[model samples]
Target chain A: MSANPVSRARLFGSAAIVITTLAALIAAVLSIGPSGLVWAGIIGAVALGYAALSFVLHLSYPDAAEAAWDEQNTVAHRDSLIFGFWAVLWVFLVFLALSLTGRMDPAMAFYWLGPVLGAVPPAHYVVSVLRGRAE
Target chain B: MTTKLIVHLRVYRAQAKLTQAELANLIGVSRKTINTIENGVFTPSTTLALTLAKALNCSVHDLFALPE
Candidate 1:
């Protein structure tokens, strides 16, 4: 409701994502009854869900007469995107590595490419937003 | 080498089988924001553009295109 509440929204959104992801990771680890990548993959899936959740939450602003962010929000947008892209890339590489360890088939790893590619643009957009690198 | 944002958010939203409120809920933005965007009252930033693009199952260029 503040005239400039983007930062607050972002902070709250980020907190929600971090908490949810961490909680999921803990839950997966505790429930698995074993110390291994099975739980790790579960954690990764939850993190991925929360990352998408953060974006959905960002879309919930109430102003029909206003845009999602203010004029200065491009920098934040770009930064988010850049971070997201790197995170996805890192996670994908790690997943590929894990799959190759003989637990999962290499071809199965390709299944993750969709989500990984999907995240890159948003991450890059975040980076660009933070850098004021609008088009 | 080229940059253009032509389609605009309004047009894309119209194609997505969503009212402003429906789309707003999906994107976590207010209906007012959705309405404003549809009316060309404001332009979405890069983050928003990506989110909307994802939700609508289209490219950013599909939602926004370069000027002719």
Candidate 2:
């Protein structure tokens, strides 16, 4: 079957958003000195711009747009949330186990949690698409 | 677990001369959703099934069925 242009666009948009977000995050984390706040602001602006562009694309494609974007997104969003919850729980469990065994610092457990949370939805989306389990 | 649904979406879509994207647009869903449903990779919710049926000018039962 031929590729659907709208789906391709969505994929491209999602990829751009995810890649940019990750890059910004990595940059922010690595440059956590005096320039950290500046990197954070850049990340926020980049993310906001990417989000706005996606919204504008949706507005431009009436046929491609949802009757209700939130409604249409509900199922996928729900799935992503569930997956993210489980993923975070798993990480927490591992952290707990490590702490109990004195192999990890309890205070450091949550240091990576934010990044883990950020990774979940995109990871879920990619896995779902690969497995053909996407809705 | 896989659903018990059987899909005849592609056949009907072909008969109607509609591409996956066209059918998806008609039903207000993503083309990926339509593609997955057509390939039996995903089971659509009842609301979506009905919407697709209505778009194709058929009943839900006409597009989907259980194995005999």
Candidate 3:
């Protein structure tokens, strides 16, 4: 059986992500020291790996990729955003409390918040999709 | 009167002799969208309902109803 052609949009999106992430990694590492290089390396590796995997999935399973972009998935995405909002709010509250008590550095809390914001929505989205598939 | 949205998409699609994927393609959506609508996991927009009805050769009222 012939494999379905991959979506051009998906291909270009993956390529863009990979390119932007690499550029950001190089800029960060050049501007910062070894510590920043370590963090940037980890983040860059994850971004690159995810982009590659997404591209491969779009290429290998065109039907599933198409399914993931439809209305049901949009509903799932909105639900995940709601979930992420509450989750991040709770995280912010916790960090605020810790900073108020002088238990955590405000700078550190602010630093970690960026990753929390980036991670929560996609994590919730993945979970929501998995739950929907299971049901 | 209290009413709940009731969907009969599966029945209509079956009567129309179309699979979920086929119905989705007819309506320019994905199979999972049709599956979720059929299983009551997702409530489609009015536009989607109308499109589905058009594709299935039925009315929206035939595919969905609000029961009192």
Winner of 2 and 3 under DockQ: 2
lDDT (C-alpha, whole model) for all candidates: 0.56, 0.67, 0.66
Return the top candidate by DockQ. 2
Report iRMS values in order. 9.1, 4.3, 3.7
Compose the digit string of candidate 1's lDDT tens values, residues A16-131.
44454445446544774544345445545655665565455556544421334544344446566677677778877887788878765666566545444544454455344343
Per-model TM values vs. the true structure: 0.36, 0.71, 0.69
TM-score of chain B of 1: 0.79
Model 2 ranges with Cα > 4 A deviation: A1-49, A55-63, A67-74, B1-3
Question: TM-score of chain A for each candidate?
Answer: 0.47, 0.57, 0.57
Q: Ignoring the other chain, what TM-score does chain B have in each prediction?
A: 0.79, 0.91, 0.90
- Quality of candidate 2's docking, in CAPRI categories? acceptable
Candidate 3, A47-122: lDDT as tens digits: 5666686788777776756655666667766776787788879999999999999999898678656556655666
Q: Rank the candidates by lDDT, best first.
A: 2, 3, 1
For TM-score, candidate 1 versus 3, the one ahead is 3
Tens-digit lDDT string for candidate 1 (B2-68): 4534546766778877887688768766555555556554567788788889999898877776676
Displacement of the residue B49 alpha carbon in candidate 2, Å: 1.8
Candidate number of the best TM-score:
2
